[model samples]
Target chain A: MRTLNPLYPTCPIRNIINRMSDKWSLLILSTLNQNNIMRYKELNAAIPDISQKMLSSTLKRLEEDKLINRKMYAEIPPRVEYSLTKTGKEFMPAVDMMVNWALEHFEEIVS
Target chain B: MRTLNPLYPTCPIRNIINRMSDKWSLLILSTLNQNNIMRYKELNAAIPDISQKMLSSTLKRLEEDKLINRKMYAEIPPRVEYSLTKTGKEFMPAVDMMVNWALEHFEEIVS
Candidate 1:
């Protein structure tokens, strides 16, 4: 009979994966991973399908989680940029592997 | 100017991670990974907090996604066992990394 690990009372992995598993979180993270930094409009353009509400809310959540850094530049137009933090950058290797896994087993998974 | 990868249209990674990111999926997967094979009751006991409904639904989803296999034996009481599929086994390294990242950044993440 296997037992649960006592160290994890609430399961932090669940919290972390739950954030990563959101429909737009990984997409935003992936986009930011490749771009290094992106403006709000640029991100909207990159992922044409995401709604303004979703993009903004997801960005806020990611920022709250500390996965992404948000920087605001006061200018004539008021600009903000999004980029992966060190922790977020570290998580990207796993994300890449996940994409590769999906590609490798695409047929098997679909069929 | 970074552009979206043309290879992914609807983003298959989203589907894969969505399945994995479920609150219970990784926990169940991590549990199954350690035990090799477990009976339904054993799994239930291992994850004591998960309601029966959630456990059943999550297991069904995992099976549908082809990440785990379910086997049944015909008998008076009947027997069922769950184990990770080949693809599931392959994904464990990434899961391990995520857990490690969570542990490494636990302090920063919570604060």
Candidate 2:
């Protein structure tokens, strides 16, 4: 049996949940999942409500966590694109489950 | 294809994710899953780091969302207890998946 000590900040479950539970991470991840790859501008366009600062910070955090990859081109204007890493791809099942559950129970939950 | 317009505040996925993704909800739910049932104080004690106000509000929100049941007994002083509702119980598979994934990828994620 796995004993969960949520009080422990270092606990994997705590860390992962805290990271993924942030306001924009899931929205960004799911958008990448749907689009396969997107430029920074495109991502900003996709989640229009996200402020530029929040999108940049969230993307940096996600990149640091290795859930998403950031690639930059050396062109005159420069270009950057984002996509999920293998681990990020592996993490989608859990996200999908949550999405499905939300769809099924949304009415009951909000009513 | 199910279109997810996360910008819409009423979107089910957005609403559900925002609620569950709150700092304490997942921890509280998982704690309840492990304990089966508990009182307000027991829950507060179980999650030692949580403030009384936070625990109280999170529990109330969970109750309001129908994810938890709050039962009251008419006794000398009155007794109240908490347990997962049927829908809450049904939601465990997704949580389990998250737990498993967190355990499996913890090192890779943080390293």
Candidate 3:
């Protein structure tokens, strides 16, 4: 009967939050927010079952969006470290909210 | 060095939140939370640019997940309305957290 309206430029709030509230982005932020910085491998371990492809892709997205900064070290195997930018640190409040929500609402899903 | 640990059964927390925190789901919940119920056409008007396929798909997902209840009316041209379930209302606090986060961090995206 009517058209579906997506939040684009004018309603970028939903658009941007959609970016941060995704599968990998949520978990990736959970990992980085607790540490000053983490190399790629350590971060992967922090998240038990993330794929390399998804991790790399998610990280790249956060990097592009300025949520996280990636620093590369010249090494035999190439070392890289990831840290949340100042802008990213602000997002942690939302992340904390999610964690608390998860713990609080965990029972709802089971029942 | 390691595989992506996508949150599944053990980590169903992130998995479930991922389902709730999506493009249409977020906006749709935002709409329904403000109102007890809304007809299909009425809900469409609330969101400015959502597509028919996505709205239908997103609503269907939320319905299946039990976040919202869909009621069909025996009326001309077939009438339907959407409402959030008990579990759905429980999700609103987390949604509020997101809204607050967005308002606080809106400048980061453009800066």
Candidate 4:
């Protein structure tokens, strides 16, 4: 009898891609990519369709993943903003590739 | 009175990433990236945790998305091999970045 290699079975590539590949995550990342930095209301306005719950949860996940940074201001009203981290910036090229691929193959794919 | 830009609201980046970011899809793509070309059994062996049903469905989605190419050889047992298409190959650098990011930040994330 032979045993399977436990190390080979755990897939980090799948894990990371699964985390980052959600609809809102990619959209939020792309939105941030374009705007560089945006406030919560700004993000909500920029991507009109996302619900507040979805946006908040996705932002939280991305922040926890260290791909995006969240900063809160001490103003009386409390200003909060989000931006890509250095790692997130490094991830933009990959995002660009995905966007370019999608744009080029859009018709073929959606048809 | 104002109207929203419908064009701006439809997110292709999100659509494409959502399609590609599933667990098995990422693993299969990474396996194909490493092996370049592999038969059904080879892929199954390469990614151990994936159930046969999950693998088959992921392969179909990837094929439909045109990210992978499936070549069938008529033999007594019938042989099918899979490889990344040009687009899929182009997508590898992004995969590399994801893997690199995972390696760099795994502990921070897992803890």
The best candidate by DockQ is: 2
Instruction: Indicate whether candidate 2 or candidate 4 has the larger DockQ.
Output: 2
> Could you give candidate 4's per-residue lDDT for residues B29-90 as a string of tens digits?
98898898899999999878889999999999898888999999989789899999997887
Weakest lDDT window of 10 consecutive positions for candidate 4 chain B:
B1-10
- The local distance difference test score of each candidate is 0.80, 0.82, 0.77, 0.78
List the candidate 2 regions with Cα displacement exceeding 4 Å. Answer: A1-10, B1-10
Q: What tens-digit string does per-residue lDDT give for candidate 2 at B1-111?
A: 233444584665567766776658888888899999999889888878889998988989888888999999998688999999988887778888877887887777776
CAPRI classification of candidate 1 = acceptable
Cα displacement (angstroms), candidate 4, residue A90, comes to 1.8
1 or 3: which has the higher DockQ?
Answer: 1
Model 1, residue A66: C-alpha shift (Å): 1.5
Lowest summed lDDT over 10 consecutive residues: which window, candidate 2 chain A?
A1-10
lDDT of 2 by residue, A1-111 (tens): 233455584665567767876659988999999999999999999988899999999999898778999999999799999999998888889888888887888778877
**Stretches of candidate 4 above 4 Å error?**
A1-11, B1-10
Ranking of all predicted structures according to TM-score, beginning with the best and ending with the worst: 2, 1, 4, 3
Model number with the top TM-score: 2
Which CAPRI quality tier does the interface of model 3 achieve?
A: acceptable
The residue-level lDDT of candidate 3 at A39 comes to 93
lDDT of 4 by residue, A10-103 (tens): 3566545567777788889989988988999999999888999999999998997788999999998999999999878877777777677677
Q: Candidate 2: give the clashing pairs.
A: none
Model 3 misplaced stretches (Cα beyond 4 Å): A1-7, A73-78, B1-7
The global Cα lDDT (0 to 1) of model 3 is 0.77
Tell me how each candidate scores on DockQ against the true complex.
0.37, 0.41, 0.28, 0.35
Cα error, residue B82 of model 4, in Å, equals: 1.5
